[model samples]
Target: MNQVVASAPGKLYIAGEYAVVEPGHPAILVAVDQFLTVKVSHSETVGTIHSSHYSNIPLQWRRENGKMIVDERENPFHYLLAAIDYTERYVKECKKELSIYHLGVESELDSSSGLKYGLGSSAAVTVATVRALLKYYDLDITDDLVFKLSVLAHLSVKSNGSFGDIAAATYTGWLAYSSFDREWVREKLNTHSITALIELDWPAFMVEQLSPPEELKLLIGWTGSPASTTSLVDQVRAKREAKEENYQFFLQESKSCVEKMIRAFRDKDLSAIQKEIRQNRLLLKNMSESTRVPIETSALQTLCDFAEQYNGAAKSSGAGGGDCGIALFDRKASLLDLVSKWEEHDITLLPLQVYTRS
Candidate 1:
């Protein structure tokens, strides 16, 4: 192959954050227009990796008996490296010869300052890298296989996240997701071959593409403060252990709310969808109060309040702390009024639209 390019969209959680960590719990997510793209080109002597997210200079690597050797100082591509390793391993098992290639990545998922907008850039990059490499090798690429490979590769780097972001990146649209049992996957990884593992049905994993009501419009607002999702999740986990009863109550309520929202989406009931969004926000607030995790920071609270003032339903997206908040409004609602209110509070309205994979 001369050069193959692949891209994956960033994701935002529509609802169900901490509660979705548990296996079989449901969450809503949407893939945004912002994307990370990877390009792979054939190489002869050495394979070079360049990333716009990193320094302008490229990192050079050579194969020594089928092993990649790179300078330690220029090794910021942990997720990319993992994706290459796993995909190459799968290729070897499928009786394909490995080849050297130059990999380059460029992303629009973050700010000019390289600050993340909590748009699941890591997941998008992993999916994009795998897709590009698979195409470069002239192997068949399917969304299901890409998702499975990305999950395996991502877990090898960071195992704390629920991997819902991976699903959104791979599927690329509005999604209703239930997390698979990671413990089961980890155990299976030790016992089964890569080919066998991808063929098997993962326990409790469910992903369904959703159709948003045509009358509803989704909006996103940035608080300008980046949040560590892993950190917030850890704090909530510690609190869950301490107050098991309250945590369980929150989980049950969240599952119920997400289910209703899913139904609302299917029925095209804009009213019910907005109602569930409000209920979901209050549930998250209660969880924050009980856990003391500060999921909804002051800036995020301001963003949500402004949406409510404009007759919309809003709440913090993902693990909160201070990233982005999402709101749902009727098509006829005055978006300018909401934007004006948000600007007064120094909240930036992001120009993001839902992206669906063709």
Candidate 2:
């Protein structure tokens, strides 16, 4: 093939945010309409990446001793380079010759102001790039492979993450996801065994596809301030590691709230959904106060409070220093009124819908 194009949707965690980092814990995620797209075409010269998200100048890279290398100054695109490197390594392990290709990546996952909405844009781009390269090389492009390769590439760039974003990007639509064994993966990564990692039985990591409840309205409101998930997660982790009693209590409560929310969703019980959403928000709020991690900012808390006045539910979606907060409502709720109230606080209502596999 002369060219290949692939895209992956961004994700939002409805519940079970920081707790999902623990192995065996579960989280509910939904793929949003926003997507990161990657286009790969054959190139005669060195491989380059063209992305408006990065720079006007196309970043050039080359292979040295079977490893991909880019100029030190162009480290912004390291995630893209890491995806290419991991895919190449997988191809080599299979004893197959993969042709080089130029990659063009573009994303609609950010706000008009160029601030990310914390919609897992990095994971989306990583998954899209891996899929594009696999298609370009005529390799197998199963969702399983996409998830694993994306996780590997993601870990290559950022040392620690739950990789729930990779799972959501790989499998579109609403999903109930259980955490994978990060410790096992860490051991394999420490040994630099890409082949072994690829051959592992990863299907044990559960991802059950689901659908949104009927008449349930979902809305995302951007706080106009971006949050660094890595930093927030690290802060939460440190607080937890310090054996904070309140932190432990928050984890248990949050986990139970997520379970109830998932059950309510599956049963299509709107009242139960609203109740659990409020419970989850309260748990997060208490955790924020105890840990001092700012899981819910004053702006997000006000939004949630306003949403509750209409019998709707709202809370911070991800790591939540700022970024976006998600609100869910029944058919009777007036979205226009909610939007107007949010606008008064300078919050922008994002035009996001649930994304599903075609």
Tens digit of per-residue lDDT, candidate 1, span 214-236: 99899999999999998999889
Candidate 1 overall lDDT versus native: 0.91
Best by lDDT: 1
Clashing pairs in 1: none
Model 2: lDDT of residue 128 = 95
TM-score of each: 0.98, 0.94
**Alpha-carbon RMSD, each predicted model:** 1.1, 1.9
Candidate 2: count the clashes: 0
lDDT of each structure? 0.91, 0.82
Instruction: Give candidate 1's TM-score.
Output: 0.98
